[model samples]
Target: MTRTVLAIDIGGTKIAAGLVDEAGTVLAEAVVPTPTGDAEQTWQAVADCARQVLGDTSVEAIGACCAGPVDIGAGTVSPINITCWREFPLRARLRELATGATVELAGDGVCMALGEHWLGAGQGSEFMLGMVVSTGVGGGLVLGGRPYPGRTGNAGHIGHVIVEDDGWPCTCGGRGCVETVASGPNMVRWARTQGWQAPDHADAAHLAAAANHGDKIALATFQRGGRAVGMAIAATAVVCDLELAVIGGGVSKAGDLLFDPVREALADHARLSYVDQLRIAPAALAKNAGMIGAAAMALRADI
Candidate 1:
């Protein structure tokens, strides 16, 4: 029988499980929403999904990724969005269903980079960055053709990169972070504060629609958001000599609504010779990047 691994992605909005082969193809998969409740309730929801996908398949190992500020050394995760789990023992708990297979954990940003490096938009790029722009902005690095988790496993966390000197305070306790302007919720919040007329429970999608119809405030909101994202990308590209950046997530679906400003900002800020070579592209794997990336991490014997 061919070797296979169990892959799981735990996000604030949803949880996904699948059986993946060594080549990054998903064999079996399942998905469930992240329920509203405490830690154990979320765990049970994930467990049920994993079992549904596992069924009668046997795997040699398991790979899991989550929204993070994760501690791989301690097998724990403390995602900003999932406040219920603060340093929760994730790898250890996953072991309960491991059936003796080894379990590995990683932050979602790192997984996105790994997956993109292996089979998505990052193919053939030796030095690159993978980013997810959603409720929050996330990023990871691929250096020398391998995933580089950095000293604390959050090396390429590009979202937290400070873009404004005295701008909005970030949830990460920083000031003027790229996330402050570009994240989905942040964009909506900013627009509302700027006199946008949002309906009840409006989200980024709703804001995009308003912009599509030529709402001046809505358009300005995305321009500001894109400017922040672009400036950050330009800084990262120069610092790391990155050749490409693969972007994915809910907010990324805004297409050129978000990217045009990003490109303009890049052209304005990245004037260095090496930085001029950087290319920005959309992610090809979509929501499946995290799962494939988790599997890629597990397949590595050298860690």
Candidate 2:
């Protein structure tokens, strides 16, 4: 018998669903705009997508990935940037939608790490950090070969780490967080303030392209963003003793323009030999990482 799971990925911009097999193949998939304002609407969006995908295949379980900071213990999710899903009961809702199937929920960051560990950048590493550098910065950790979801299943929230006490305000009601500094939208905002003349995140990418062609201000934006990210990771390395840092998402599209500065900052800030030894690399799972990781979560339940 073919074992399959219904996988859901809910983000600020999109909600993606798929029927995935044990081999991490997406048998059927669909994506829709995430409904804003109404929690019920957002939940219905996900349920509808799942129903559509399930129509194409027989799935045995449901694995969901939502934006942080989710309470995995409670099977709940707070409002992400794009929606009013505050404290919504996601697992139970999905369970209701799927009827007889088992349901599991995790932060999108954790799903990325699980995907990488199963078949992407973290394939051979025992200690891993799966990071997403997109509209928002988020991540999940695998420590000593286990998922380590913390007491509330919010352990690997790398984005919210206070890298600067005097940094910009974060959506999580914090200041100077890694997300404030390193996220694509944040980077673009910072660049615009520096007189780079960009209006949004896409403009930051345009500036990066300009920097690739020799624009100093564009280069400075990436450098500053990289430094903040590197500083945060340097701190994380000490606590998690991570062996590999796998970065993914749209912002990572900046490539060496982003990693080079991050590497330099990490090398400069990571004073400890142990922390210095940690390797940072790009995420290989790409767009499929979330669904694949959710499947991995079902298959590998030990940690």
Candidate 3:
């Protein structure tokens, strides 16, 4: 019989759940807006979504991906963006919801990398990094064709990697991190600071639209963010000897406005031949990468 796993992705803004087969096919899925009230409310939303998606389906295992930092051993998570979830016992709760199946948890970035490695942009690469550049930045790595969650399950946190010695403060209690320079909100803020007039509900998409329309300030904003991301990728490539880097999340939808400068900056910063050969590409599976990755984790315990 074919094996199936329950896959769940938890983010600050939304919660998603799905039933995935061993072949990376999503049999069924559901999404719900994340509640901002409290931890229990958020947990309820996740549980409800999972229950709705699963219905009467039976799965062999359950896999969950959430924002970090995660304690894989303790089966807990403390996502920075979700304020109420400091040291939340996510794995236990998921296990409770799923009843008899095995439940596993990892950082969202790791799941993304594993998902891409199994079925997306990083499919053929032996070593790869996956990054999410949305409200916050996160990353994961795949080495030797397996997801590497590191000791604390927070290995590929490239966003928190200090890129600027004296840059903006991060929620993670750090300064000048890549997130300060490259996240969607920060990029939009930088553009506004440079006198870019934006609509009342301005965001990265709005900024991208302006950039596409030849707005110098908006264009400069993307370039600045892209360079920061490129620098992070270069550093990671040098350290991890990554063969490919796959980028996803909301801001990555900006197309050439983000990628062109990222590649240019990579060329300028990565002097070593090995690092220079690193290829970066947009995520192939788009929004489903996390769920698929989560399923990969559940199905392959070795990962």
Candidate 4:
């Protein structure tokens, strides 16, 4: 009999829950808009989604992939972007929902990386960084075959890594963080400042498409984001010396518009021999990454 795990992914915009099997198959899934400005409301939304998915199946365990900076060992998180969850106890709440089965919590970025390491692009690489570039940028890593949850479970939070010492202020109370210049919304904001009057994020995509089709302003925005990513990745490579970097999330859809420049920037900045050889690739798992990653976290524990 195949074992099933209930997995949940909570983000700034939505909450996704699913029943996943040991084989990494998402048997059933559902999504609901995240609660606005209320942590209890958001937790309730997550529980409701999980209950709905669990109505027809018996899961042996539960795993959650959520926005961080979370204390993985402590099972707590304070997603800076989500104000209502200032130091919320996610692990305890998840346990309450699990009813009896064991449940685990991890940074969504780490889960994404775990998912990739287990079944996607990072399958063969032991040292890798799994990145999600969306409304905000975030990541997780598997170093020495184990998830390295930094001193406070906020490891792999590449988003807040300062790229510009004097750039835009970040939600994390820092200026010139990578996410400030590289996230989807930030890219759109940057484009607007460049005289590209895009009304929202879709316009930013259009701008990228335009750049791909030879629009100068849009091309510049991608270059700016790419440069920030490159600088950040270069810094990480110097520190982690990882074998590969896998990027995912909705904004990754920009594809060449985002990566080509990152590669260029990385090449320009990576002075060390090993750093120069690092491979950065788009994430292969896409939407299912979190569920697979959360499940992988549990399975890896048994090994």
Candidate 5:
């Protein structure tokens, strides 16, 4: 066995693939913009990107992560943003692509947790939560030093945790979800409603820039988001007894602008002693987390 795996990270904005070794090093990688066209276009992009990394190389296993909610049993994924791929037969397609190799599948949130647990800020913690704060909010749990993907393979999904009773509508159908308050798009949407002076088509990065420049509304937006996320984290900690939370993804790049408030909110609602013990840290692996975590799944197929 080569001890290498083809790792794929499927997201709404991009599809990434990497050749990852057992030690978690990405020897080769490729990326492609997720197509806005039909499902076939998206699948072609994924296949091409994976092939770009693979070239002639063959691996014994393939580990794949997609934005959830995923049915790992059915090997199907229905990423909310990528509407074209509802119940897409991802694993079967991958299997067809690789004749002899085995394929492992997981939600991106699960992969994020697993990656952090394997070799990131979550190291040394047997029970932790890995959260990705980006265009969408999602999280996963590492319990007993292993990823705990529940029955539909989307356990520890903290985004759906309701923060406000009737604040904003979420893609998940529920209103006032933690994601409504904290996810990048929702944050920007909230900022817009508050009369934030923003450029046309401004995103979370733009909002972060305004916050860094001392824009009060923008700062307040981060605070609101952080508060929602922190409250959800505290809730999760109380329930799961998590030791730490490693947060990553695009919006987390805002640094202390986002983290300071998260810490403050975590403190505010940390009613229980065990919940107060939880720590929140930024992801150390940058953008490679999901792919690395997918590789981690391939490394320990039985887990």
Candidate 6:
């Protein structure tokens, strides 16, 4: 009999759920807007999406990925973006919803890394970092061909890693965190401050377009953000001896406009021989990586 797992991805803006088979194919899926008001409502939205995706299908296990910082041991989550949930008992709740099926949970960044390591950009690498640079910067690590959640399940949180000692302040109460400089909004803000005139409804896409059109400020913004990301990658590579770094998220869609600078900056910052050899690539699974990774985690026999 083929095994099936219910995969759930919870984010600040939306919640997605899918039923996936052992071969990593999504059999069914559903999505819903994340409720912002109360914690119960937000959880209800996630549960509803799960039910919608499961329907009459039976599954052997359930896997879920949510924003950090998650406590894998306690099965609790305290995502910074989801203010309604403070140390929420996510694992217990998911277990209740999954009933007879086995349930597992991990940080979204870790899930992304697992997905890429299993079937996407990091497939051939033994050690890799998967980063998401959008409204916020997030990351996860795959070591020895498996996800490493660390002691507190927050091991791969590269976003909070400080790159600049006295630069911009971060929401995490840190200075010059990767998120402060490399996130989409922060990049756009820096561009606007530098006198770049965005067409309308200014966003990272618009900024990328302006850069593509040879806008000096827009180009500079990418360079600056890319440098920060590169510095972080170099730092992480030095510490973890990563073979590859896979980048994804909304801003990553800018393609070469973003990657070229990152490559250049990495070359400049990575002076050591081993660190200089680190490779960076775009995520192959795109937006579906998180859900696919969740399924992968659930399918793990040790889980």
| Of 4 and 6, the candidate ranking higher by TM-score | 6
* lDDT per model vs. reference: 0.91, 0.83, 0.92, 0.84, 0.91, 0.90
Worst 10 residues of 6 by lDDT: 192-201
- On TM-score, the candidate that comes out on top is 3
TM for every model, in the order presented, reads: 0.96, 0.95, 0.98, 0.96, 0.97, 0.97
Over the stretch 92-200, how does candidate 3's per-residue lDDT look in tens digits?
A: 8988776788988999999988898899999889899999999999999999988999999999999998889999999999999999999999998888889999886
TM-score of model 3 vs. true structure:
0.98
Candidate 3 global lDDT:
0.92
Positional deviation of residue 203's Cα in model 4 after best superposition, in angstroms: 4.5
Which regions of candidate 1 fall more than 4 Å away from where they truly are? 300-303
Q: Which ten residues in a row have the lowest lDDT in candidate 3?
A: 95-104
lDDT per residue (tens digit) for residues 1-303 in model 2: 768888888899889998888788888989988887577787888888888888856556888888887898889988457558878889888888666878888988888888888889898898988888888998899888767677887888899989889988898898999989888888778777877764444555686787798878788888888888888788888888888889998888899988998899888888787777889999987888988888777755575
TM-score winner between candidates 3 and 4? 3
After TM-score superposition, the amount by which residue 26's alpha carbon in candidate 1 deviates from its true location, in angstroms, is 1.5
Q: List the residue pairs that clash in candidate 5.
A: none
Question: Whose lDDT is higher: candidate 3's or candidate 4's?
Answer: 3
Clashing pairs in 4: none
lDDT by residue for model 1 (1-303), tens: 667899999998999999998778899999999987899999998899999999988777999999889888898989888989998999999988767989988889999998988899999999999999999999889999988887767788999999999989998889999999999999999999999998879988998999999999999999999989999999999899999989999888989999899999999999999889789999999999999999998887743
Q: After superposition, how far is residue 262 of candidate 4 from its true place, in Å?
A: 0.8
C-alpha RMSD by candidate, in order: 1.4, 1.5, 1.0, 1.5, 1.2, 1.3
Model with the higher TM-score, candidate 2 or 6: 6
Candidate 2 Cα outliers beyond 4 Å, as residue runs: 199-201, 301-303
Residue 175 C-alpha lDDT in model 6: 90
* Residue 290's lDDT in candidate 5: 91
